[model samples]
Target: MSEMVIETSNLTRRYGKKISVNNLNLHVPKGSIFGFLGPNGAGKTTTIRMLLGLIRPTSGQIRIFNQTLPKHRMQILRRTGSLVESPSYYGHLSGYENLDVIARLLKVPSKRIDEVLGIVRLTSAAKQSVKGYSLGMKQRLGIAAALLGNPDLLILDEPTNGLDPAGIHEIRALIKELPAQYGITVVVSSHLLGEIDQMATHVGIIERGHLLFQDAIEKLREQNSPKLLLQVDKPLEAKRLLQRAGLQVSMDGDILQMPNQGLAATEDVNRRLIQAGISVYRITEQSRSLEDIFLDFVDKEGSL
Candidate 1:
């Protein structure tokens, strides 16, 4: 069995009458990019804070690196790196200088500074002042700082927030490579389902302080069964024929809709329709997008 780098059970956090996070359980496997997803005010940040031991949970437990949190906070933090929301950078200092300051504070060797800069592809901009850096550069610099400690797990909260399309893509690519290239487990929080679909190996979705889904990205894709749409000479006859053939069928106006069982089933359907003298005008296979699945889960749960 694969090791779980981060795990939480019934984790809850409340601000007086307002419950921020309600009974959340997260399982992040080692060396996998785990995308933490939720809408605004979905308690993602609160959960992250609790994980870092910056705040105490209202109830439940947290474990990281196979040890319980708060009790092992110092030990866990030594092997974890994080960048939450916006990163603070000194405007007057050059990028290299900023990292040097952090290295000195963390007692990290000076050589590790250059190595991290290269990892984030910021070596070229190392001498450039942070004030002149683009938003993407600044974000990458923050990640480089996070990597300074050579942590086993990396946590990032909306690392691409407030960036343009190109910046978002750059950060996304960097994040996708971290687990494979650097052997680090990552927990990235984002509200954008499309972005998460591209890079995350696993995902956990939260809405209105409630967890809606948590599983591998492929498992989530499996939930969205493909459908076949047929335009035939007689929609009613086609629907009835498919139903009699032990296939679930539905009519949408002049078209017949059925589950896309695969090539053999499609061939069977075509053969049966042709035998019935029904001309098949067109057949289209439609697969649901991740956005569709996300919306369905959120809507079904009524987590506005």
Candidate 2:
């Protein structure tokens, strides 16, 4: 197993009467873009706050870079960079100037500013006032600030929120390249599945204060199990016949659908249907969309 860059054990937090984050175990592997996914108010921000040591967990522990939080907070923070929600910046300051301000605060050398600006593709616009920059440019600038200290890990919470489609794509592409390009492990939080789908190598899905799923993106994709989609000449008859043979079946208009019980079962069904004079026009394996699987997890389960 790869070393975990971030791990939490039964991490919980509450505000007043509401339990914002229930017992949650989140694991983020080193050098992987781990997508912290959930809907709004699903404890993503609250969890992030705890991870950054901005807020204390009511109970449980957070381990980053293999050292416990609070105990090694300063040491861990030095190797980590983050942007939570919208980044704060002085509109009058140029992009370079804004980063220069952060660089000085971090005690980073001035030369490092140019490198991070280039990494975020904002070197050309480095001299322009931030107020004149588009939302995407400003976002990249924020990322550049986070990168100023040359962090080993980057945590971004909703970095793509309220952006145009083009802007979202820009951030997504940048994030996808960070792990290999810079050897940085990223733990990005988002309520948007499509954003996470395009960039992350692994995923942790949270809902109503509980972690419902955590695994490689491919594994989550696997959760959408393939089904045998059959376009039969007599759809109703095929469904009835299949069900009678102890096969659970469903119909989609003129199609018959059943669990894809591997090749042997599929062949047996085909043979049985053929023997019954039923015409099987087509046989295909279809899996549900990621959105469908995601919705199923969030709506029906406490964990997966």
Candidate 3:
């Protein structure tokens, strides 16, 4: 079995009367880019801090690399690197100088600074003062610092928060390479579902402090059953026809959606629609987006 890099059991956190994070469970597999997803104030940052032993949880347990946090903090931290929210940098110092300081703090060799600078594509700007660096450059520098220790696990919270399109793509490509090239397990938090959907091998969705789902990206896609959209001139009659054919139909504006259980079911519905004289403007299969899936789950649970 693959080793679990990060696991939490019934994890909960509260701020006085407000329960910031309710009973939550998560399992992040080793050597995978695990995407942590949630809207604003969904406790993503808090949960991350707990895993890093930066803050104590209100209840439940957390284990990283099979060892409990806070208790085995020193050991776990030695093998982990993180940049939460925003990474701080000294404006006057060169990129290399900043990493050099961190290397000294980690007791890493001075030569390691050059190596990290190269990894983040900051070698060219190594001698340039950070004061004139662009937002993307600064972000890259932070990433370089995170890699200074060559940690086994890398946790980045909103790593692409302020980048433009090209910068975002650059950072994304770098993140995708971390697990494959360095054999490092990565946990990334993002509100951009589309981006997460593209990069993550595994995912965890949280809403209103509760964990809605956790599974492999492929498994999640498998579970999102395709539905058929019937765009017709007469939606009401079309819906009735589909229902009469033993197909469950949902009314959305001028569209009648029915679950596509199989090819036979779809063919049966099409035949029925034709027989009913329901002019089908369009009949298209619909795959729900991650945002759509998340909202449905949260609203169903009354947690939205």
**All candidates' TM-scores?**
0.97, 0.92, 0.89
Of the pair 1 and 2, which is ahead by TM-score? 1
Residue 297 of candidate 1: its Cα lDDT?
A: 84
**What tens digits encode model 1's per-residue C-alpha lDDT throughout 1-304?**
7899999999999999999999998999999999999887888999999999999999999999989999999999999999998999998999999999999999999999999999999999999999999999999999999999999999999998999999999999999989999999999999899889889999999987788999899999998899999999989988888888889998889988889999999999999999999999999999998899998988877745
> lDDT tens digits, residues 1-304, model 2?
8899999999999888899999999999999999999999999999999999999999999999999999999999999999998998999999999999899899999999999998999989999999999999999999999999999999999999999999998998899889999999998999888888989999999999999999999999988888999998888888888889999998878888889979999999999899999998999998888888888889886445
TM-score quality measure for candidate 1 = 0.97
Candidate 1 regions exceeding 4 Å error are: none
The TM-score, computed over Cα atoms with residue i paired to residue i, of candidate 2 is 0.92
TM-score-best of 2 and 3: 2
Model 3, CA-based lDDT: 0.87
Name the best candidate (by lDDT).
1
Give the C-alpha miss distance for residue 239 in model 3, angstroms: 4.9
